[model samples]
Structure formats: structure tokens, C-alpha cells
Target: MATFNKFFSSVFLAVLYASSYGNAAPWPTNAKHGTHRVRTLGKGVQVEAFHPPSSYKTYGAGVDLASSFTSSGIEDKTVSYISSELQVDSAKVTFKSGYTQNGQSFAYAKQVHNGIPVSNAVANVAFKDNKVIAFGHSFVDTSKIAPSTPSVDVNAVIPKTEEVLEGKKNEIEPTLEYHALADGSVALAHVFQVQNDEAGTWYKAFVDAHTGDLISVTDYVADASYKVLPVNKELITDGLELVTDPQNTASSPSGWHSDGKSNTTDTSGNNVVAYKGSVSSTTKQSADNLVFDYTYDTTKAPDVANNVNAARTNAFYLVNSYHDTLYQYGFTEASFNFQNDNFGKGGAGNDRIRISVQDASGTDNADFATPPDGQSGQCRMFIWTATNPKRDGVLENDIPLHEVTHGLTNRMTGGGTGECLQSLEAGGMGEGWSDIVADWFSHSDSADVTDFIMGQYVTNDPAGIRSHPYSTSASTNPLRYSDIAKLDEVHNIGEVRTVHPEMVLFKSLTFFFLPNPL
Candidate 1:
């Protein structure tokens, strides 16, 4: 089943950013002081807005509290402005971070009351030319709220937290923290980080210290590893062809197409390694190595295990190669590329892309899962067994590339939070993006690149799995925006909008802006 987690905040921010792009109007030269507008933002909070002169087309609003302000002075001014305008105490708000971007300074703050942090209570302030230009806040009044005191000891809550963890031991000792509940109340809780090594599960549990009841639990190790020895080998894609060894790229077939290294110790390393599925479905068992020889006769089908091994090698090479190719377009570690080992200097340091082949029960599909940021992303390719001769999903390049692109779109958008592409339209856009990227990677001038057929070899179908090939020709597939309301499936809608107009516009801009070699 296809599912996408909803991320409303990220989606709203994306729209706001897109709306403001390339629409900057000239700033007013004669801006005056004491000319500001105030608006109520519900929950007893207000925002004092100061816009540039009427002539400026750029949209920005904030409090005009100061003529000149620095990073150090932003918090004081923010608190002072909010306190005066909203009639709230400055001590109730806490500043989180202040930084400069694109010649504008931005700061984020959170609300706290009675020693308990307010959930979903936030404020953002922006400044330009040393003057406040934009400010927005979601606040809660704490004047009448009472502080919560724990009745139960931390030791008493440990057993309750451990019970919810199913006997998983706490990696870190339980700590006391205040949590804001949904009903606008605060509670003292004991937070525990629990893990089960054999099962490869990690969880964070918050247990109420007053009642010893479990408040919430989040699985950090969201259900989501190899070996190698080889030089050159014959692999099959369209047909049997000698390719570079995946283990060591610098061998006799020196310039082998799929040459890359593998490392089992470092989970976040650049090595493209493949591992066998675990024996138990619930627990994460150690992976066994898939030994590769120099050559294989593709004319005759090999054993199922051997076939999967070859597919794994091909997938590793293709993913790594695409990773390198995309690097030129800013898909680096700083930009949240899905590789454990990042060569770039920016982004979360330990995040990496992990691939698993032929996982559990030999299912007929592949899926990509991206957990919260700073955690490794996972892609699983299953075995296709419906046909007379069973097929390995990894054997085909398009399938693996399609799954990998999910990680790309998830990471690159929404600041690597994996939340930007979760809406209905975004979901359809995601499927289309994957298909386009897969075609781009596997395309050749002589091949039918524009046909938009997927998994033809794996599924053994001439027309492939999709209902129709995505094309611009009206006679072949004339899909328009009006058809969206009638379609209920994401993939179906994606096929109809085969070539997204936004994607076309983006490519055009990229080609125009980037330096031409010629």
C-alpha cells in the first residue's frame, strides 16, 4: 500500500518560499518611524507589522522597534516588541537561534510557562538593513497556568517506560522533563531512550512522573546492511554484457562501468555493499556475504540466490554513480544526499542511504522509507515471483533508480526533514520525478527513452505495468488538470501528468542559468 506522512507545516513554508521568489521590488527610500500596523493572531497574541514604502513590491512585515539592530540585539528587541504589543511578559518567551541568510537576519523563539515548554508555540522574526521587516508568532498565555510537580519518582516511571518498550533497556538514563499536553496543560514526565540491539529497534518513551503512565513513545529506529570479492563480471540488463567488478573498480576490466568499493564495518560509508535478508522478520540478524566471481554466463539463468547477488551489485553501482552525477547539481551532503559517507562539508554529519535486497517473504514490490533527519534512510527491493520464472527487483536498473530517487526528493526538499513531499499533489509529483530520474539515468539516444515504460523485463510485459506510457502527444495519452478530480490513485494521477509543467520550467531555468561549456 502506498502511504505518505502528512507534514502541513513544511508544505505551508514551501508555498510561502515559492511565492516570494524573483518578486523582490525596490525598497522604499523614504521610510518613516512610528508607522506600524498591528494584527491579532488569536490566543491572546499580536504582531506589530512594518512594511516598506507603498512602492516596494516585495512582501515583508515586522515591528519597527529599532532603526539598527544586530544578531546580539535581535532577541531583546523581539521580546520587548512582543511584550509591549501582545501585553505578555518577556520572560515567557525564549530565543532559539539567530542567523543571517540572503542579506536578511532571522530568529526563532519558543514559548515557555511555569517551567514547562509550550507545544507548537513558536515565533519567527526577520530583519533587513538593520530594521525589523517580518514577524510571526503562535503564543499561549501562561499567567493563569500552574506549574506541575511530579508525585512519582523517576525510578517508578522507569518500569512503566520499560514495559511499553517490551523489555528494551534504556541506553540513556531517564531524565525529568516537562511536556505540554494537547489540552493546554503541562505535565512532568520521565523521558527514556530505549533500544533492543538484536531487534534493531530504538524508541523514545515519555512517562508521566505523576501517574507513572506512558504519555508517548516514538520509534527512532523506524523499521528499515554486506560483503564482496570480485574484479570483473558479466551482468545482464538489456542483455549479457561484461561489466566492471563492483568490489574493486581498478582491475583488469579497468574501466568497468559499475566499479565501486564495499565496507561492512562503517554503516555510513560510501561503499556499495549488499547483504542477505535476516532469518527472522521481527529481529535484525547479521547479514551474510554474497561472494561474486569474475564472470557468469547470462545466457543461462543462474540460481535464485546468485541472480539476486548480481542484481545487488548492479544496484550499488548505479546508485553510487547517480549520486556522483547529481553532485554537480547541489545534491551533496550539505544538500542532504542519502549516503552515510558524505564528502561535502555541510548537512547532518551521520545521515546515509542504506539498501536491502530481497527482504522478507520475497514480495513482488520495492519501497523506500525515510525516517527523521540524522537517521539512515532505507530502500528495500523484493523478489517478483508471480511470473513463471521468478524475477529479482534489483536486476533491473530502472526499479532501483526509481526507489533511490524517493530518497533524493524527500531529502532535498523541506530542509532534509523528509516532510515536504507528503501532500496529494506532492505525492504525484514524487512518482513522476522518480520516473523521470530513472529514465535520465538509463537513457540512450538509440533507445525509446520517451516511451515511459517501467519494469518491462522484471514483470515480463511488453507495455510494462503502467496503464499507458507518459507522453506529450494528445492522441497517445491526453491527460489534463481537469482529470485530477476523477483519479483517486497517486500513481494513476502521476501517469496522467507524465511530464509536470513545473519540472519543464525548472529544467529550462537550470539550462539558462548554468554556464554553457560551448
Candidate 2:
């Protein structure tokens, strides 16, 4: 961080001089064009976006709005140290929370301007060896921040915003915050999340507090409904049901069916593309008006192949569902999430997931291929021949989700590079995380899936494929860390990790953190 600090101090001083010379030097930053590209917004506030290939460590550095980390470095500092480095009063920066990932520690501080917080501002500094490794911040130059004292009635902003947005439900009540402008100024803004589930509309609205006028709306619904076996209802037992626009608005504003168009008839979309695999031609399952209502056949062997479209539809549905669900937990475009169009958010684009249903590559098992960022992820679902009438792996919701979770753990662990989980133990932990993700997504909040069995539908096994079902009770699942003594392979190694309730729920907390994963 010394290098980044010196770099920052120089820019800070330059901006200090710029303001002294009667110019508005608001967005002071430490970014170079080649290393870290600077983009000027319409408001003239410059933003420094770091491009990877370098780490934010001693020589390698990177930082962003959500999180910060160094590529190669030691340990990390305090709030006072952070305050001094950021050139801000310690009293003004209020830390919301802190957590650690990999070997480095991280803290999230909300910038406060004139007593009120900056709704979209953050001060990011990650340090090691008492030297700042790499840091990023949107902490307002308090001197340039617009005052927070509201001119309009604070209470009146809520109803006006809801009316302007035509929101049926106010998920987050209107709150005051100092909003930064592109022109090196700020606005007293009212921020809130509004929902209209019936109309499939949801977004976070930023309103000008002074005039009670809607300023901006960030879509929180990238959701799309699908008719397929849901998480809890696997094939052979549960029937298909309609999942009304399940994609999240924030993660996918255009929703799942859209790949630049309003709706797609086939099983290809911005988030995932599902089709038959291993054969000469990849046959896609098309729907009428986006209603992918394919019929399933329970007959034996070759006859089961007749209903391959159903499997394709199901695979597409499950993969997209997993993609959107994980996005809410921080697997975003910048974090190397699979998506056709990132809408220029960050990371690589055109790497949407590919799902091969009834794959000819293998049988009785499924797998996922996770390459580096910018490369598309591939998930192949095989046919299970154990039963007299073989089952299509794609028909089972958990099967596709389980495989897709492999991509999730792989891309997220190593900075979206997809090469981090290579060691024996790391590989084993990867498998464990996959199981936990699938297990976590397989049930609802009210359901008791502690003794969860994985791939039961595809494998046609009552006991499930894992060594033991995940359970809280020792008598039921019994496997523990002590069992690691007998396990060398990754799958069994992962089995020992997933049963812990604390670790399982720990994934849920990631929703609060901005994951760099890179």
C-alpha cells in the first residue's frame, strides 16, 4: 500500500492544488491509464477502474467500490490507520462490518458527509506488513459534498417516490444519504428498494431529497419464471410447476429470457444456453411465449430419449436459477459470473453458462468445466442407466444445480481465474463448497433439510450418492472432521466439510460483502 499510498498522496495533493486554483477537484484518485483506467462520468467525477493481470500487493495492486485485496502480501491495520491514509476524520467514517477471506482481512466503511452517510460511497484500503497493499475508495471529498440538510419534507419523500416508481411495496423505506454527482457535487438523496411483484418489477430508487423527485432507478429484478422441477421437488416424485419470473432484477435487469431481445423461444438466454449434447446437432427446446412446458416420459432406456426436450428445458431452468441466486450472494459480472452480456458492468463478457442435456460425453455422472474469466462455463448432465428406465440427469433439478455449483466455487475462489482450487485439500474443499451450495439451494426456509441427500433423483438411490447424507445428528450422518483420516479423494474430503451448520450458513452472510473473488 506504500506505493499506492504515495501514488494516492501525489494525486490528492494535485487535486488539493487544483481546488485551490479555483477548479473543482472532487474525485481525487490514484489510477494510471494503462494499469488502472480512469473513466469520467457525465458529472465530471472521475472513476478509477482497475484492470487485472496485476495484484494490489507490493508490486501487484487492485481495489474497487465493494472490496479490496493485494495479490502477494502479508497481513493488514486499524480504523485510525485507515482514516489517516484516506485523509479523513476518524469520526466521519462509520464502519458497518468486517470479515476475512483467503488470508487477507477486509473492512467496509460507510462514508459520512455532514453527519449523513454517503449512500453510494465507500473507503477501501487493504494493507499488509503495516504497508498498504492495495486500496480503493469512493469516499467523498467532504468539501465538495452537497449538504444533507433536507429542503423537502423528509416524510413526504417516501410516498412521492413510491408514486413515481409505481411501487406496490416499499421493501426498504426511504432514507437520507449524500449522493455523489458526476459534476463533482452531491445531492441529499432518498434511497430505497421498491417492489411490484405482480408486474415483475423491483429496483432501488435514488431520489433527490431537496425536490422530492425521482433521480435514478437501479433495477433489482433480472428474474424470469420457468416451469420445471424446483429445488425441493426433484424428478420422478414431484411434478413441474410455474416459477413466476424467478430471476433477480438487480443481477439481471433484462431478465433470463432476454439475450438483447424481450423474450427467446428456445432455451438460450443471456444467463445460460441449454441444448442437447454429444450428438451431431445440439437440439434446443423451444417454448411458446416463453412458456417452456415440455412433457416428461417415464419409459425405459431409448424411449426416455424421446422426451429430451424436457430435460433441456429443465437444465436451462436450473442453471439460470443457480446463476441468479448466486449473483445475489456476490457472484457478479465483475466477479467473473457467467453471462452473455454484462451490460459493461465489469470483468469479461460473453461467458454465459452452457448446459448440455442428455450429454453423450459420459453416463451416470455429471461435470462442469470452469475456465478463466471471459471464458464460458460448461455443465454437462449425463443419463443415469442404473434403473431399467434410465433417468435424464437434467430432469433432476439438484443434479444441474450441483454441477453448476462447481463453477461457482471454482470461479469465485481464485479471483475468477478458475485455477485456485488445484491442491488436494483445496480441491476437496471445492467439492465441499459445491455440496453445501447445492444442499443450501435444494430446500426452503421452513424445510428441515439438515439430513439432506444429494442426487437421489438422478441416481435413483434412496441413500443418495454422497458417502452419507448431510445431517446435524451424529447418529444419522455421523461423518465428521475426524473421518478425514480415511479420506484422500476430494469428494469424501468435501463430505467432511459440508455437514457443519455454521459453515453452511456462513455462505448466507456473503450477501453483505462485496466479493472480489478475483
Candidate 3:
């Protein structure tokens, strides 16, 4: 996070002085007007008889205060106060808005000079108990600012905007606005809004009206990706495993997971599809997606209501965590994440992940499908029933992580456009990467890498779901590049290259040394 050191120098000195006086000192009070109590702290900066109780104080340049204050007629009161303190004309300060709370209010005003608004010049006055308390200002010196008019017309800048946006320009007239420059000066600029529906891009461009040069641009769309109440039922992650009940199953409260704001119906946020009915085709059907509204029932055994609810909640949490973590590492809107809420900034909407729980078509398999760009990716987690008992694919953490990693690898590796790792050799590499990631999450501790098994809970088999548990020993997996022809399947071939001792060493080195390298 960035700190405003340039704006808080006086406040820091005041804090040090207050610390010397000890805690019992009375709160700092502002001095009387037209007195020597006001002292110059820095160039164009002044401080009055300030004795704040806390270590923090608000101070700024071009800030002045009035002799008296009142809550009623706030605009007139604030304008008069600023005019007297800064020794500027009262007509120059214009009231913007009043931010109010219980017995407190903050009047925000902007400075307009010679019919042109001064960019970044603001005056804020704090009031408590209907009396003046504190204030801060960052006003430009009006005498130093020279008046100017725009030279180029708005129509002349349209072509330049289209060229920069590479998309259709929004059909709106460009507005003339004063923009602040890097040197603390303001200029007349025309702001243009441009968007491209095909590419899911939107931004605002500021063009210098005098020279037709692009001053700056701000992108609007941001990545915001969500919900449920009723009797909350969810799967709680107990270390590496997920358990239905965090406490006693019969008496404990509902443990359903939530992002704290969204509801049970998945259509609103992040749009997870956890359905119970069967589907005729492998593709996701919007109508068949389950809506989580079940009341809590502890006595009920692994039924659809509790099991599917847990699946939906766990899937939403896991996918969102991975998405946000990857975003910090640069997998952002340009990289194509599955989300609908673009945060009013830049993102291709309608790309939410479609997750299907207990897909009826198969009982022992789970998979993720990465469609073309701008389309929703589909993830199907099937039930495991090959053994004497049945197991849900969602209950286990490794299964979902392994499946979702496929989508991440697909979108990130190909520049958000084409398929990645399509050849036989590449397919093996893809599977190996997914397994390695899942293992990282499932491992008991950072140093413990002896166990590299996948889906141990879902499958009772000693080897788990794979042909052989992953190991860093040549005896367990001795296949070399020349042995690629010996195996035809992708998973089998992946084991040959994945379990090599050299690959394990490389993964360990990167995981421990790199900062968010994944």
C-alpha cells in the first residue's frame, strides 16, 4: 500500500510533541483567529495551537479556518470559513456535498478559478457536535494558474480514441473537463468513453484538447466475483479432509460455508451449478442446476440436500481462493477468469464456472472443460461407487483442486486464446502439473513431501485413483523420454515423466524459493 508522505509531515511532528506531554494532556485545541498562535510549519503550510489527544492529525496546504462555526447553513458557513483563512474570494469555493453521521458532518468543497475548475484542489471541514473540529485542504494557487481555452474540437479526437481502444467508441458526446497534470497544473481535456463487446473491454480516455494528445486513461471494469441463508449446511475442511459436521452432528449448528454476503441460489454471484437431477447430454444445462434452499437436518444421512449443499459451498470457496491468489500473480481480466461481475471495470462477463455435483453419467470420474474465450468453463465432479460403498467427489479437497487446475493451466498457458498442451507429450505434462499442484495443497506440512498420493479418500484402493502413487524414486517410475512410445494414455504417460527424481527436486526448489510462483 502507498503512503501519502508528502501530505502528512506537519501531523507527524505534532504527534512527537504530543507524546512528550504524556497521556493526561488535554486534547489539542485550535487557537483564536488573527493571533500569533498560527505558525508556518512549511512553505505554503501553517498550523494553529493544535493539541490533539491522539497521535494523528489532519493537515494540508492552502487550508484556512473560520473564527466561528455552525451546522445550519453549512455551505455558506464553510465558504465563509475558507475565504477568511486562505484570504481568497468566498465566491471561488463551491459546495460539492456534505458527508454526515451522528452529530458530525464533513463539508466537501472544490475551488473554481476564472470559470475553470482547479484540478485536485479540495477543501474538507470536519464538524463534531455541531462545532468546527478539524479540516484539511489541497488547493492550487489561483494566481499561479494561467487561464487557457481548448484549441481542437471534440470530433477531431474520435479517431485517435478508436485507434487507442481498438473497439467501437461509445456514442456519447465528449465532455470538456479540467484534468490535473504531473507537474501540479491543470489542462482542458476531452474525456471519451470507449468499449468493445466482442473483447469485453471498456475504458475512459482523457485527450488534451489543445494538442489532441492522450493524457491518461482509466479502465472501469474490475474483477468482482459472490450467498446463502436458510439452515446453513456446508462442508468444513478439517485439515486435509472435509467433514460434514464440525461439532456433534445431532446438536451442532449448520456449518454451511459462505462468502458472508451472497445467498444460496448460485445464479447471483460466482454462479456455481450444483444440480441433483440427471442430464441427457454432457454439456451443462442451465435449467438443471440445483438451487440450495434446504433446511438444516442433522439426523439426515448423506442425502442430496446436505451432500450437494456441501459440494456447492466447498467448490465455490476453493475456486474463488485459487482465482484471487492467481490474480495477485497476474492472472487477471486479460488472462480470462470465470466470473460474471466485472466490478464495473474491464472483464469479459458471463464466464462463470459451471460446476455439476454428482454427475449421473459416470460414478468414478471428474473432469473440467475449458471452452473458447468468453464462454463459461464447465467442471463435472462425479460420484465414486466402484467400491462396495459410494463416495462423493466434492468431499475430498485434492479432487476439486486437481480438476480446477486444468482450467487455470488451459487459460494461462495459451494467452487466453488457444488450447495449451494439445499433443500427446503436452497432455502428459498437463496432468503432471495438475497432480503436483494438488499434492502441494494436500501435503501435511511444508517440509513433508514423502506422500504424493492423489484422491486417497475418494478411492479406497491402496494406489488411490491413479495407476501408481507419485514418488521421487527411479525404481517406482523409471520411464525416460525414449519410453514415451510404450504408453498411449495421457495419465499413464504423465506418471512416467512426473515421478522422476529430477522433476520432484525442481518442484521443491521452486515452491520454497519463489514468492507466489504458482
lDDT for model 1 comes to 0.48
1-518: candidate 2 lDDT, tens digit per residue: 33323322322222112111111221113212112323332234343322211112221443222233233222223355457666778777766433332234444455676678765454444443334444444555556665567788756776665565566445344677776554556778777766553333454556677877665544322100456787656554778777666667787888777775556667778888887743223334344456666567776463354477666767777777777666654567765689878887766787888777776756888777676567677676778888877877777766677778777666654345453344334455557766766665665652344567877876778887887888767787777665654665668867776665444442222211111111
Residue 282 Cα positional deviation in candidate 1, in Å, after optimal superposition: 21
TM-score of each model, paired residue for residue: 0.55, 0.55, 0.44
**Deviation in Å, model 3, residue 19 alpha carbon:** 62
lDDT (Cα, tens digit) per residue for candidate 1, span 396-463: 66777777777766665434545333333445545666765665555433233354567776677767
lDDT tens digits, residues 323-402, model 3?
A: 55444433445446565544433436566666666666466777776643455666677777644446677666677777
Better of 1 and 3 by TM-score: 1
lDDT of each: 0.48, 0.57, 0.49
Runs with alpha carbons beyond 4 Å of true place in candidate 1? 1-237, 243-272, 278-305, 444-449, 501-518
